[model samples]
Target: MLSLSFLCVIAFFAGLVDAAVGGGGLIQIPGLFSALPNVAPATVFGTNKLASAVGTLSAARSYLRRVRLPWRLVLPTTVAAFVFSFVGAQVVSLIPKGVIRPTVLVLLVIMAAYTLWKKDFGKLHKPVEIGRREMAIGLAIGCAIGFYDGLFGPGTGSFLMFLFIRFFAFDFLHASAAAKVVNLTTNVAALLSFAIGGHVLLAYALPMAAANMAGAMVGTRLAMKKGAGFVRVLFLLLTSVLICKLGWDLLQG
Candidate 1:
């Protein structure tokens, strides 16, 4: 078992990474598994959601205070994400994610490559279109991404950011801000299901949540200060790490 001190450190860093670009699972999940190898998979996942959701909530609040979010889009997508995510979690057992891992790998590779090639893709804040049409697109993106989050549980925020950038023409910062709101909904849905299924470990969740919240405050502030270029860079870096991680998992499987 990892020392409590060590776990706290991990949570802090995970929150920082998650708040910055939304891949805290890359850090927190492995740590939990390594520390408690005997624990059930659902327990690990539930605990992770507990920790990550706190970080995401803090980050979302921070972003909302500073960034101009599209409320119309955020509202509908948030609702859809919450509903679909719950359904996805319930049906996750019916689906085998192994079948989709290869396709996900390919998509991640392509997204990373495209981001690398386009130096200024999401650097500046630009809205190509807006209003009802954009809101509808956002809703579609949210449902798809949210379902994936509940079902397979990797790269949800990165996917959300990418879709917002491509389809709705949001810059990295705004995309990230919006992603948090949707991610929060998905996390809540999954967490609720896990709680009901008796998977969460609250003893560990509380301290981790505190650490995650602190880290989120710092990370969100930094992202806001550095602007879209820094976010774009971080997004690509996180995406690359995710691709490598998923690729390794696929290969091992």
Candidate 2:
């Protein structure tokens, strides 16, 4: 029988992967579905948010302490992401997820292709002018990705890092830091919505959360030590894995 112990083990590794590259759901969501096959889908998803939130938050804290993340942009980006995530969660009940998955798969494919082709894509940190234009762009990125998180939510962190690097000219390290902040906000938004709907299962969530925290600490520390080049390589690896995962889901659908 699949027990809470087994789930916690999975959560730990998910935290490690998620902290490093932002696709922890690629490991976690499927684990939830497979381990607790009889559980209600809402309960499963809710528990996932709770468990993953702890690890994600742990990673965020670790990154903030070590990385000189830009708070000016992160603050606004977080707020925008939170509001849009709530909006996305609300919309999830009204729509079928099928249409979105294929679209996301295609976009992930393009993102992967671009990342692979551009050898020095996220290597350098180029600070941009912080103005109305930058703020507006940050807001747009936050809302767009946040909504996607609440709606589909597998590679939210990866998407955030890539976009920050691509548009804002941030290095992978800073982009990952920024991504953690935005991702944390989205998780909070989604978790609240799930809890309010009485979907969260605390028994399972609590244990997994603890395990995730442990993994998060290790992963975050490793990322900080390795720097942008390491992060860039890991990002590509995770993106490719995500593409495969999403593609399989689309095919099965």
Candidate 3:
């Protein structure tokens, strides 16, 4: 088993990367699996959610301080995500992960290719008009991705970032900031379920949460100072990693 110190270090970097562009699970989840191979999947997932939720909140708070979010849109999206995430978690067993994995792989590929093709895709923050249609769109994005997060549990952040940029016309920075808020909501929903089911390991979760929070602070500051262009680059890199990860999983399956 890996030492707690080693896991804390992994959590730190996961927080840092997640706070910047929302791929922290790529690091933390694998570390958890490696460190706790004998543990039940529920406990592992629950612990991850607890640690990640705290880190995501830290990043969201920092982003909210500097970025002016459109609450008109953000509110509905967050609400939908929180509600539907629970629904998704309840139905997780009914859906086969085998089906979800390949679909996500294709979507990631298309998303990555489109972002690469569009030179200025997320460079500028030009929000669409806040009409009923836009609000509905936000809710739809929230519902779909939130459900996916609950059921399948990969690439939620990347998916949210891309949707925000593509539909809401947010730049990379704003999209990331917004994605943090929605992601936090979903995490909290899942964590609550796990906690109630007695799946969370508080012994590990608390320390990792603290480390993740510290990392989030540094990451948000770096992202704000560096600007949207830098975030766009990181987004692409993370998405590329997601693509490779899912593709490999599919091949193995």
Evaluation by TM-score, superior candidate among 2 and 3: 3
RMSD of each: 1.3, 1.3, 1.0
Candidate 1 lDDT: 0.87
Instruction: Residues 144-218, candidate 1: write the lDDT tens digits.
Output: 887888888788889888887887778999999999999999999999999999999998888888998899999
Off by over 4 Å in 3: none
- Residues 163-227 of candidate 3: C-alpha lDDT, one tens digit per residue: 99999899999999999999999999988888889999998999999999999999999999999
lDDT of 2 at 202: 91
Q: What is the lDDT of every predicted structure here?
A: 0.87, 0.88, 0.92
User: Candidate 2: where is the Cα deviation over 4 Å?
Assistant: none
What is the alpha-carbon lDDT of model 3 when measured against the actual structure? 0.92
**Clash total of candidate 1:** 0
Ranked by lDDT, the better of candidates 1 and 3 is 3
